[model samples]
Target: WVRGTRNGDMRDSPEESPEEQDRDEGSSPSDAKPDVTWLGTPISELGRMPDCGQQLPRLKNVSGQHTVLIRTDLLQNGKVPVPYPAKFTDTWDDVHVKMPWSGMNLFPVINEVMVLEPDAAEHLFGSLLPDMVQLALRASELCTKPIPLLKGGMNHSITMSQEQVASLLANAFFCSFPRRNSRKTEYLNYPDINFFRLFEGASPKKIEKLKTLMCYFKSVTEQRPTGLVTFTRKSLDRPPNWKSSQSQLTKLHITCEGTIEDDGYGMLQVDFANQFVGGGVIGSGLVQEEIRFLINPELIVSRLFTEALGHKECLIITGTQQYSSYTGYAQSYKWGGSHQDSTPRDGWQRKCTEIVAIDALQFRSFLEQFHPARINRELNKAYCGFARPGERSQNLSAVATGNWGCGVFGGDTRLKALLQMLAAAEAGRDVAYFTFGDSQLMTDVHNMHAFLTARNISVGEVYDLLGQYYSSVCKSCLSRRPDVSLYSFIYQQVSSSLAPDASDN
Candidate 1:
């Protein structure tokens, strides 16, 4: 019995009858606004749109309104016979697409004006067309009924089937959500899951990300695995005294290579995400967690219901299947190939893995991160993600994470590492920290942990010592030592705090 199985399947439970589904499907296309259009055309009508003309041919829906436009000859059996413009093709010298014998192909059917170079179209939609259409239809049908929204701050989990994930993604693919396009302050609270943003600014890197996403959709729709996934949010009323506890630290592994997904399988992996949930999934921001979302696209659907994460709130997702393989990081990213996830499932027919998304604070100034309020916020956030659900009796697995806020967020790596250890200690979980090629961080963290372990210091004591250390460091710029690192500062503070007075002796 999995932790969240008591409620039965939360997705596509067949509870809704035909009449209920029809009523919830909303009105016909005629009733929809003129601007509303389908995402792409059916596979049977692939390549119907004229190519290389004065103006691109646009597909119109039944209501005689403009829809998506696609070009078929651009791609055939994964071969890009038509070359792309120099700008877009510069990075494709070594690129190759290995098409499966029989799979679907999808064309970009967008309401907005998009002029595609023949090469770009072939690279994006060459081998994954028909599967995309099926996913789109399934998504639209699921969206007919409102997704049941769970109240935030509740310590419970929701499990979704693979079919449910496809449906949710289809809705995102077509941009069918009513009020998500706007970035206005009023809509800031909602997650942006639509792919329209990615289509706006076309670039080599952006197209590569789009290609990666398309491959993910193809795998999930075609494979249709019977596994299930779960999302759980955990919140705590009070912070735990991590330093004072005598509990041994969970198994710790430090590395400078490998990623969370590839190296940390069967463990509770961490997604260093943005507060808005689906960081840049629908857009072009490809970093740590965004890259993860691209590979395991099923994770994208959580944005539909997930609100902006609070400092004390974190989401733990279990059983999401990885669909694609990617190469490179950030701007240098490229889609490698399709991946067949063979991870074994648990008793409830779900992959026996977990991923926790806990956002680290984005500090404007490096020194601003040391503020007690900010520190406490990060501590709570990490703890929320690491904490196990109260309903489960089993022990929690260790966490796999690295460089949480060091990249785009400009966080101090040493300080962030200490914070993660503290939070993991509080929750009684060990950590597998990947430095991602930062050897200095690996060495520093190893030394710091060794020192702390030798002293048998508890997390509560470390928390107190951090307050004093930061205070001293903040007193005056001239008085503060320029060369002191966070690890050295803590080591010095703890050593002195435990030192005996000569007079008392």
Candidate 2:
């Protein structure tokens, strides 16, 4: 389950394609035993639920073919491996999930979290197993309604209750939803939404993540959630005139200490996502996007319906609750306990939190991202994420983001930062950037912002200057110039362009 990755955005590692990775579901073996006493108290028998009561909601605008609500009882085709060409949500097979706890008992898996020993975890899971299954069973009901697949090139949004999100996450925990464990053709485009990958590798970070998820499960099992969340996939049919527009850069607040989740309040938070959205969260890779998905488990539901993001597409998730607090990034990541979310809600009861996921291109070589096409692609993706309804209007909120596609993606931080700022300028949004503990980067970006604002430069100037910089560095594109750092080049060229000329009118 330790797959390869390509980018700093935290995907499966570079060497492996998505198809080559995770061929096996990596679930525990069938021979694994359950604790009869569950370490002390008796494990409760699975309860017989009356017909599920939750009302299934569908998009009023379209026929209901796109959205598949889970009605487990109705899903009893009695097949282990589901029939081909069917989505798990559509089939809702009973054989994969029913009775006698197939594969391994969940006890030892919980022990590794160190938050709860096998005994304690068994007690908690075993006790709540009945109710958890009940929630999983009520998925069609708990959700405000069935969520439509966020297919590429289509603009769509779905609303679900927080209890609905938790219930769906509970389903993910049980791996009850079928056909998600492998990279099969039926669900090849989607990220694996099952918990099987969380148990893979059993690394310390994975353990901590499991603990955090368990905490989320515990809380939701105890209380009813009234808050709601919405997932919106926005696609741009037309983009801005980046090389011609005179739009000026907006306000920038750069910091190195705080993070996007904690520090970025009342702003559009950016998820440096992979094209596959949740990236490697269910697996061993725990980075920015994966960590965010784990902490806000509700976002995991998108994996059930969202397809691979198209180049011009971006995903916006509003009102997702952060169930757990966390420390560190990637492998150093650790799970802190429950976070009580209190953000104000809209009339629809959806939390006010808004997060946009924009996938950055992975550059195999240091110079790859500097290519004009690549630069424009990243800029376009960012612009798509930053652009909102009536986006040209002022009074838009600031975009909270950091160095996207840098680190393992091999993107130059200075270039990425400038591109994001340029994108924000075009979208009419300000930027609140976190340098991810890099004080020098924070200072450099802040100074760069100050220089641009002080000179009152146009967005097209920077955009074209970036193209020139790319052409200068990329010999194949055009004649070469002496290469310098991106910021230094920008400072020199922008100043020279603004300098006095003998032929001035």
Candidate 3:
């Protein structure tokens, strides 16, 4: 979400499309705004579960207070969102539990965008509501299970049962998470936990999103996986000295086809992230990050406590299994169907998939990125995410990335690619660049990589070259000249730097 204090607007860069955002989406009669001003009314018959009188300090941290709705014990001690009570374990499980009256405390904020079948309630959970309650009883046990609350400028990691994640998310489908839905809610900086917004909107796109979510709940409730998922916050106390490193460019495979999720497997996949990790999945903003989260709803749990990323911090998540499939991006987005992720588990019992979430600076004015400080911030961010803790540079996996933050964030793709290249090279990892179906980008980036390789360019040289480009072209271009692309300028500079002098001739 946009962290602007000027207007109190938490606008997010939920890039609706690659090029442009749909200005305003009108709602049909069914798509009218959902008024969730109340949560006492149960949509489904919920079997009561007792809230044992237990007391523990609610989960709290610098990021913000965490409200685990599935824990009824926390709710008993005035943890506000405890709509109803549920006691799964003899203990409160540290997560406030309430047998959700229904599937989700789906918020009203997304009602304008969410549309489902006329009998959406019966469509998915009709007769299954009781079974859902039983499943939530199982899921509620994770309430007090500590999901490492990721704060800024500190390293943290969370590895837990995939079953626990699915359980917590199942509760999210049922809207007991009231605190995160309000403007002044406790998780003011966090994304909304309730799907109520999408449920009320009744729009086709929101309907599609909800459908995908329903599929996840259906899939897990039927058979919960025993795999583990990990979320690690890597904070770089000292970024590499880019000006002195003699690192060489790692291997690169740029393609105009395929995706980072499916094709770029067994590597470090990049999440072109928002300061708020999940972006606008619960809202109208749908793009790379949102789509990824929808397909793997477990990632959405990071919104539970992941504070907005600091400049030097990045969150690395491993073992997230893709659940559903989809076609298209933003407005053209459509859920394909259930995708059973058969990716093997590592020794950690987590999925083999490794995704690094590095939030790029939203270059409000693309030109604002010309400043070296902006470039430095992104380079360090990428390195913080890419650098492995114990693995040597030789063993560090390649990075799968494309036009990160290049959409509505206004990142110059060329500049971003070079910056990432420099970061990856210094980290001693290779790179896999997905052009996202852009042929020209593929050709240009490939050509640039080839030129740099031929020159046997060192990490420091490339670093200096970027600085020179910013100074010689971008810095002056804002007022005096129309600057050429970084590739063109760098090609000229690197070629000239290696050129033969008259004395040599």
Candidate 4:
């Protein structure tokens, strides 16, 4: 998938290699007019604004050749012929080909250097497109059908069959839902899955992302899996006194290496999500959760109907399959290749793995995060995500997470770690923290955990200490040791309280 085709594939057939096929057809290796036309109009002008509820235009190729235009930058010595239309000549832009369906006016963005597979294209539009369109229409009708909201520490989980997921995704594929694609502050809270941004002002990076997405669609449509999946939104009421608890703190393992997905199988994986749900899937922002969604494209479908997660809310998704492998981070990311998910299904035919999406506050100023109210909000958010409905400690698995909001969100790693630990302890669950290559954080967290453990400090004690530390910092009492780390401050506070008379001895 990512590398294109293998040597022994159909591309190597006697008719012509895929690249040569592009050249021999309407696409010219040298600057020459393309043999195809749209009702005598130039290919560039074929992009007309679509009407209401109109289907996307049909794609056509000259000489009955089914070809896909791939961007040149992604290939070696790849270039769209100079004499082609201005849209095709631009090196910085994705190749924009007008669809053939009359009155249907959507342009499918493709690279300038590749050709399409007729069989693949036929299967994609012929078999999949109609059903996808119908599904989208049906979903639109149900948008206002009044599903119950998860509120006030309530626990709710909905099971969506594979067919239902495909339907939800179909709406996203067609960009059918309204109130998306707007950057206005009000709409910022919602996830946008429409390809409008990708279609307009397309970039090489965006084009690659689009390719990975298309490959995912191809795989799912070809072989519809019979498994069902579940999405659970959990909310929890804050305990009045987390400090007075006598319960021992849940198990804790902190490391500066590894990731939630790779090392923490069978554990609940944490998705450091944007409030908008899918994060930057439609854009170029690739962070922790975004990267996870790309590898497991099925997870992207959640954005279809998932509203922005609130402060007291968290989403738990089960049974989404990982369909692709990727490398790099953020802008440098690339789809490595196709992946076949082999994770076994449970009695419900759902994958046993579970993922929790919890959005962290995007603090503008570091100090804003330390306020008591802000801290409480984060605590509730994490606790909501960690709490398993009706499950006790014996059945609850440990949590797997990393420097969740530390990257783009500009969060304090130590503070975030402590918050997570407090929540996990409250829910009677353990934590496996990955620092994601941050050695300093790993060491510091390990030392802090050790110090707290040696003194048998409960999570409630840590919570009380955090309040005292925050007050000291706020009152400028700790300005004398301004460089002191959060962990050190907490450690000193806990030690003094635990062995107050040891200093005199």
Candidate 5:
């Protein structure tokens, strides 16, 4: 089962006129050669690492393996094959993070992090998943709003108010219900203060449209009704048996009878592995890595819309906001790692192989089995547009809502990491680390095989590395905007006696 992609409405039969098709064909003719490009070495074997000028260190536990980490800075050439627009969340530092375990809570309490505990992740992540979904959906909806189409020479693009765009992105990431009287920080309610704000100049029509969209979303789910809950009472409501449950799992489903149109706010249902699958470490040969893949239409919709808005695919990475990064399309080539002469070492190869076997079915089944629960949740919350019991209500006046959206899957950015690593390899760097997910580590290796064949350390080991990677990126992002406050500034901006309807100055 795929862990982190939502199923999408497959009915997009965009009619292409013959003229249009011919025009497109004329622009880029089909080639006889396959589009696939292997950066180095044979597909069957992991290659060796080449020496960079930098010194290399020995890997832990691999007394026999000569491992040296490689680092390089370079972008890949060509349109890397992104099957679908990949979905990824932009870290506060501008690093693209992948979506791993489902449910909306992208920002889990850093202090509360416990690797491999699915149940704990669910409770923490689920608490905010609904809100996150709402924000993503609302943002997408805003994108569909009527905008003043401004033609730029031959290309026509809608004019988006800088504020509107900021609002849309803020809504996508920080859009949340009003802070509860309780001081507990809700992930959904936190918007970044330094994020790009109001544009210097704005058109009246564009501003008006932004207001209308924001107001419309506000009116629909202001109360945060625990709507249409899905997932069987046996599977959802109560927590999962984390101890026996898979080590890493995320679940999602919709709860209601609404069609994709009218109230099809994208998200129908969602859940995740609650336990850490506690166990003692296995002996060297006995360690097992299991990835349960899941895909739901709601998630797909959420990702597609986000991809369009960000102009970046989201599927490749893994983990949560401020917690983990992705490695899918954006970093596929070098995500695993790189070696010299195009060969992947034993460690790098292992990471790449793990990437290939990712299961898409597990996630799909989680939703399929719980379809009834989703319908029931929909029934209970049908009174209001969207609902989530045991959670704060969405503020109708805010530009975003949690329940009205969907989520990206098991926050892993495998593809993006690989691509980045490949670019590094080409640029002649030693010991490069790709922070797309818990994976994406490379040392001195010559070919793809050498890099691909390297033994992967435990996910826990990788997790530690990721924590360091993300922390550095976060620091970099924070450094760029030291003066910006997050939620405090947002509260101040909207709290002025000025109602949203107030005319633009």
Candidate 6:
């Protein structure tokens, strides 16, 4: 949702596929300006599921003819077409519940990323209390290679918390090193720091946790069986000793997070061979092979089997990885904008430098109950025509006037009740109706059902209504846009609940 303010606009990046890019390249549809596309790649009813869970619903493979909306001004009025082909209807979820309904509200913190380098490494990693350390503890050690977030500034940083650093370290430490004949240390300039650098002058308590974290990394590196994966440098690449390997080769078999079925493995090499004394190569030192892997932390966390702490079946990991670096006062975009074209080229040069992980099981579980059905229904009803309560218009008007802009009621009792209802809802309860602000209107209705049958309350109707309610009829009618207040609330609540607090934000 793009919210317009007196000053500027704020929009969240929803995942769009190649087809969506094509449609966005053209004229937007008159009726359906792009709003939130349905969640996930469309799955058919007969879609495949992971071996562990029930099959999920899928939509038909969309064709290019589908037209989605695009901001003409953002693209200089179509000078450069975004690769978003919005060819399908803005689909709401299929299932839903009535309003005045309350179920559950759970927000989970899943993943985070940060910059760690000589300048900020101490600041970033020093803040943790050992007891709270989760990922980068001994079990998973962090590994590093030169992955620049800035265009030319090699002094940039990529830092994650101890837990993620540990997991990352565990996954990559002791992997094959780049061969001496073809070293790339010039590209890998970030100062190397690890668990040892941390807790150097630690308290006994902090030291204990640090020890535990280090031990975990050590055990994995020493005992875990290593495996091999190929890293290909196209012939035209720049010349470093490593790049000079003319004959095509599968040089390193680094540890990675993949079996056979999943090929999301990443490529990395820890260069310990080249020694610099007075900026020149010292007598050839024994090449130390540090570990690096091409693995998505989200996939790893998703696959882990655990029952303790906040655990959920499906963890929802959502966030953007952008190029950014710190100046004096604030962060400036490292790359001007999302480097859609340059990402593939530069991504290969950049390596995973740090990890910031979180436990999102509770949040994921809460989100599961709503799904597309709940969101479609609630969002639909919030806008559709209201069913007049039994009370007179004056009474209803009084309630509306009273609650206008009033923060959600339900107080402490309501919060407790909502939490209880969420638990019951998980067991499949009929309490969704009570969750809506306009409970009297959206009686037990599926979101798609409302979309199909509710003559007075289409999804568009709700958007218009919200635009009308939040900003007033005159402004909405004039601009045909909802105010920032409406969508910001939705995004703020959703994002913080889904992932960890982004320091970059």
Error of 1 at 157 (Å): 3.2
* Per-residue lDDT of model 5, residues 1-505, tens digit only: 0122121110100111111111110011123322332222221222111211122232221222211111111111211111111232222211111111213435442113222244653585433334333444444233333222111111111112112232233342332212211225321121111111222245332232233223223322332211110101111123222123222211111111111211212111111111111000010000011001111111111111111111010111111011011121110101111111111222211111101001111122222212323322322222111122332222110000111111122111232222222222221221112111111111111222242324322222222333333343324453243232222232233334234555665
Residues 127-241, candidate 6: write the lDDT tens digits.
3322222323322112221111221211112212223323434322221111111234322331121222233453332332233333333333333311111111111111112
Tens-place lDDT digits, model 4, residues 1-505: 5453211000001111111121100101123323321111121221111111123123222221222122112221112111112231212111111111112323332121113455775685555554444444443232221223223244555554554465456555665433455647234544666656555555665666766676666665676556656666665555435657555566667654345675665678888787766676666555456667766666776664466777887888887776676654444556666776666555445566788988888766666677778888888888888876566566666787766666445568888887888888787777787665455566676677767777788777887777776777744633333355677788777766766585587
Cα misplacement distance, residue 350 of candidate 2 (Å): 1.4
Model 5 TM: 0.16
Q: Which wins on lDDT, candidate 3 or candidate 6?
A: 3
User: Deviation in angstroms for 409 in model 2?
Assistant: 1.0
Per-residue lDDT of model 1, residues 1-505, tens digit only = 0011010000000111121121100011122233312111121221111110123132122121111111223422222122112111111111111011102212233322233355655685663454565555543333222233323555545555566667567657766554456767334575676678878866676787777777766666656655556666566667665445555444457765556676666767888877776677667566666667777887887776666677788877777887777765555566777776777665434566677887777666767777677788888888888876452213455666776776446577788888888888777676777665556566778778877877888777777767766677754444433366667788888888789988897
Q: Candidate 2: misplaced stretches above 4 Å?
A: 1-126, 140-146, 391-395, 476-482, 502-505
Q: How does model 1 fare in lDDT?
A: 0.58
Q: Candidates' TM-scores?
A: 0.71, 0.76, 0.77, 0.69, 0.16, 0.20
- Expressed as tens digits, the lDDT of each residue in 1-505 for candidate 3 is 1111110001125533334353111100122333421121121221110111112233323333322223223322212222123433333122322223323434432232223344664775673544455555564444443344466765766555566677666556665444555749445555566665666766677877887777777776777566666677778998888888898887777765567777666778888777778777877777677778888888987776677788998888887888787775667667777877777655445567888888888766766776778878989898998886565554455777878777667777777777888888888777777665556566677778778887889989888887887777777766543458778778888778778897987
In terms of TM-score, which candidate is strongest?
3
Total clashes, candidate 2? 7
Clash tally for model 1: 14
Q: Which 10 successive residues of model 6 have the least lDDT summed?
A: 397-406
Report the backbone clash tally of model 5.
Answer: 188
User: What TM-score number comes out for model 4?
Assistant: 0.69
**What local lDDT score does residue 323 receive in model 3, on the 0 to 100 scale?**
78
Give the range of the ten consecutive residues with the poorest summed lDDT in model 1.
Answer: 4-13
